[model samples]
Target: MDTADRLIESTRALLWERGYVGTSPKAILERAGAGQGSMYHHFSGKRDLALAAVRRTAQEMRESAEERLSGPGTALERVAAYLLREREVLKGCPVGGLTQDPDLMADPELRAPVDETFAWLRERIAALLSEARQDGALGPVLDPADTAAAVVAVLQGGYVLARAADSAEPFHRAVGGVLDLLGARVTD
Candidate 1:
């Protein structure tokens, strides 16, 4: 990749892996295989590069979710697909993990993409649930807003649990539990 691309990608990985507080300009340059001149040429500094990285990560996360959430299927099926999709569970979520970084959260520019990503996800999931109810695929008793939040909570919590245990089983179980709950509400 080009210098700018490499720098952005390196920042994304570093931010995900090390968080903003832990990531340094020197480390980013080392990881990106670029020099200080290249990084400064492309970005004003670490924060600027991190913002670009965050934006790219947010876009990627949205596209990944859209692939399953917008695919042809019942709403629950689509959600299950997203939840069950292959992931590097041990590494945690690139976007969700950023929320844990106090330094990142302290910066409005750095946090905007993370905040926007979740907002978009929740809205999209709620809309999917609403559509499913309208189509008689989901039970009318389900609250789209509450259920949407629950779904996201389970996924993020699952990642935490999995990381703590050093296993992907917790993540799978969480997804399975959610699917079971939703399965009970799926209309014929």
Candidate 2:
């Protein structure tokens, strides 16, 4: 990778491993194997590099979700595919993880990608649920928007629960529970 690419990738990993407050320019340089001058030459500073990283991460998250959520299957099946897709559960959601970073969250520029990602995810999931309802795959009582938010909450909260317990089991169980709930709402 080029110096700029290396820097952005390193920053992304650092941001995931360490929050914005914890990810230092020096650490970024060290991780990227780039010189101090390289970072400055490629970007203005740490924040600039971080913005690039966050944007990249957010874009990737959206793309991955779109692929699964829009893939072959009924709406419920697509949702199940998304929920059941393989993930590094212990590491947590990259964008979701950023939400815990006060320094990142306090900065609108830094937070924009994170906020936009979740909003898009919620909307996408809502659309899928609405499709399912329209097709009679789901019961009439299901609220697409509210249920979509719950689906997101369960996934995000599952990360926290799993991280807290130092086990992926909690995450799996949370996913399974949510899937069961959604399944129960399925119409015959």
| C-alpha root-mean-square deviation, candidate 2 | 1.1
lDDT of 2 at 69: 100
> What is the TM-score of candidate 1?
0.95
- Lowest-lDDT window of 10 residues in candidate 1? 72-81
Scored by lDDT, model 1 comes in at 0.92
Per residue, candidate 1 scores C-alpha lDDT tens digits across 57-128 of: 999999999999989777777988898899999989989999999999999989999999998998899998
Residue 143 of candidate 2: its Cα lDDT? 95
Q: What's the TM-score of each model vs. the native?
A: 0.95, 0.96
Name the weakest run of 10 consecutive residues (lDDT summed) in model 2.
13-22
